[model samples]
Target: MTATSVGALLLCRADPEAVRPPAHLLRERMLLLPAGTGWSVLVPEGKPWRGEPHDGPDAAPAAPAAPGGAEPVDRVMGGWATALAVGATWPVIALWWDGDRSGYTLAAGFRRPVGYVWLADGTPAGEDEAMRTFAARLSLDPVLDVQELEALTRQDPEADADARLRELLAVLTRAGVALPPGLAPGEPADRLRTAAGVHPQVERIEWAGWRDAVQVELDAVESTGLGPWVRGPRARALAAAQVAAGIPLTLWGARRRGAGWLAAGLVLLVQGALGLAYDRFRAEAERGARGGGPVW
Candidate 1:
């Protein structure tokens, strides 16, 4: 299959660890790596649209129903983007392509996703409404941003997918997304990896085996401000829910050969276990700090 058929990049304004949760939620086997300052890239290993996880209640209407059937790609990207954006302080963008089309979706917070589309030949196929929505969702200056966006849509129809993506990137430069030299759109996963590894600003994210990974996660928690939730009843509840949800998810993914979902379940398990551990650690630390005053 060609690059368009199997390759996609999910860009998020969070670190790779923060990016993993939502990607797992989408059940996609994506390689996570740093993409430049304040950004991470998720490279989907397989076609994400084939067996997308259900989006539950807040899901937008299915993508196949979208104009020109562009929603299939959009939904997966949108779902992942929205998952990362909600309950966080950053936005996520999914740049995707299939054999016949290419487009992008920008999701921020709980607001609706806005996207732009292009035909396989690079003909602009998205509605002006999408650009308007895109600008609004990002809180861009109404006059200046809209003008730049409008100019993008008005680009020469003969431009190819690569050109279109470049134009999109140009528009996003202000948002601090400086993708590395080798992380080009439409490259196969292997080629994408080879390039990303040597790029000065890119770092290949890996399991580093479970023990090291877990320790790294614990260390991460120390630097984050999740102390209240991680030390309270809500953290316990969330950890329990993650375990409960992860088992079935992992089983289901294994049965269906869904690498994405399987990875997602594993993440949930890790997060849940870590939350519990962090809470216990906090309790112990508190007791020690207070001279072991009855162990709370």
Candidate 2:
């Protein structure tokens, strides 16, 4: 699948404390746009997918974070459809950060399929609709045939591919879904099977929320650095993410809620353009404060 299939895009923040959604707010539609059939699954690192630093693994699959802060590591998250057969070869995965996990690899049946972003049927159920529906009930765990997927994660020395079949069989048994061995995984074991749907795009939006919060915090640190004309580590990092996403920082600025203290956008107006004006304004204000100049 195209790297763009599972693209991770982000915009910069002006206020570190400001709240915003990572994905564009559905200003119009109340549904999640189907991303596409190219399945892009990501396993984020760090505590609960907070935006991590610049130099690190992109997909660190550690436990969720606690109240205390810690550095986040990276892990892999994107890929596309593969044949359902037993042995699959290396699939193509595009990379943005530095690491081997950023690319694709040869794995088992569930390594990553071309994701179909829609309701179970062929219809567009945007993030909002998905979330609304999932909030009550959604299908995510359909007794996956894990033998192939587990094989991708590690070596399996089983005599039969039936191990996966057994796992799925066990899950169905527990869910009270009775079916014959002849039934396919996708074929409904029962009428209620299709009732539950998975909303991946909604999950991605939540992930973006965590990132937005992180960016807002980073924005505060960078804003302070800007006044001194130094490149704060966080600012440099934000710029790098922009570059990777193939979007201009300026467009992200447009997504900010309110301007800076001076009503400047996400990144303040470049000092090159506003520095002298700022200094002159500061001088006049200082002079007036000292009662040594006209208060124009």
Candidate 3:
């Protein structure tokens, strides 16, 4: 693929409605659209990786720097995938390609992300075990899907990086992923954004400040009947954990100026804060019901 074809797509194994709330927490402009039965695709409007180098104190020591200090496409997408999947039930698969390489990073829950890469010429550059892990995480057909994924890791003279990505998507079709027309792999980031913007069902996501974001998240949780998990000591402990994890992570991201980690840390902090607030609110309401006093 040409350098100009640098682009990435975040495929979430969830409906757009479920993906919207956490997506807003990313604080980046993106276009969301349904992919298939239970899949959604997020096309980022800005290419932050192409911008100024993240040399801040929070910058990740291992983050690879591209020419002019820009973060590599894979690194940026991988971070974003992790951010999106951290507190959500569904997994996020980030498919990214640049002039020199192409790969996919799959992040689910708090587990370590797993991925495989290929050179621009389609030579596999990752471990074979990664494919097995990928298939297992997605719950794809153990024998059939594993065989197909393994094929992508083998040498293929006719396939280029773009072709490899396409083949990977082909295997995912069985798991209900049908990308919209013109949203194909290897397209330029601007073009991908344009394509996503045109879809009739596309929804634009932007940073709307913490107040709005927290409200949306709370509404989502309530509507999804997740309130039970938002109250009680267990929930409070989880919130505390999130806050504890987020502080250091946010600090690290700030120091390094890494968007992915920053987003992740912010998400954790917000979610933790929300959890604490919700728990308190519910407790007061119950107390008021028992004639203790007004909740407010």
Q: In terms of TM-score, which candidate is strongest?
A: 3
Each candidate's lDDT (Cα)?
0.68, 0.28, 0.87
lDDT of 2 at 273: 30
What ordering of candidates by lDDT runs from best to worst? 3, 1, 2
Model 1, 19-45: lDDT tens digits are: 654445454455677766677887655
lDDT for model 1: 0.68
- Residue 258 of model 3: what lDDT? 98
Between candidates 1 and 3, the one scoring higher on lDDT is 3
- For candidate 1, the TM-score is 0.60
Instruction: Specify the poorest-scoring 10-residue window by lDDT in model 2.
Output: 9-18
**Candidates ranked, most accurate by TM-score first:** 3, 1, 2
- Once fitted onto the true fold, the runs of candidate 1 whose alpha carbons sit more than 4 angstroms away are 1-5, 20-27, 50-72, 197-220, 225-296
TM-score of each: 0.60, 0.17, 0.71
Extract clashing residue pairs from model 1: 27-260, 27-261, 63-71
Per-residue lDDT of 212-270 in model 2, one digit per residue for the tens? 44543444433553634334344344444434432334455456532332233323335
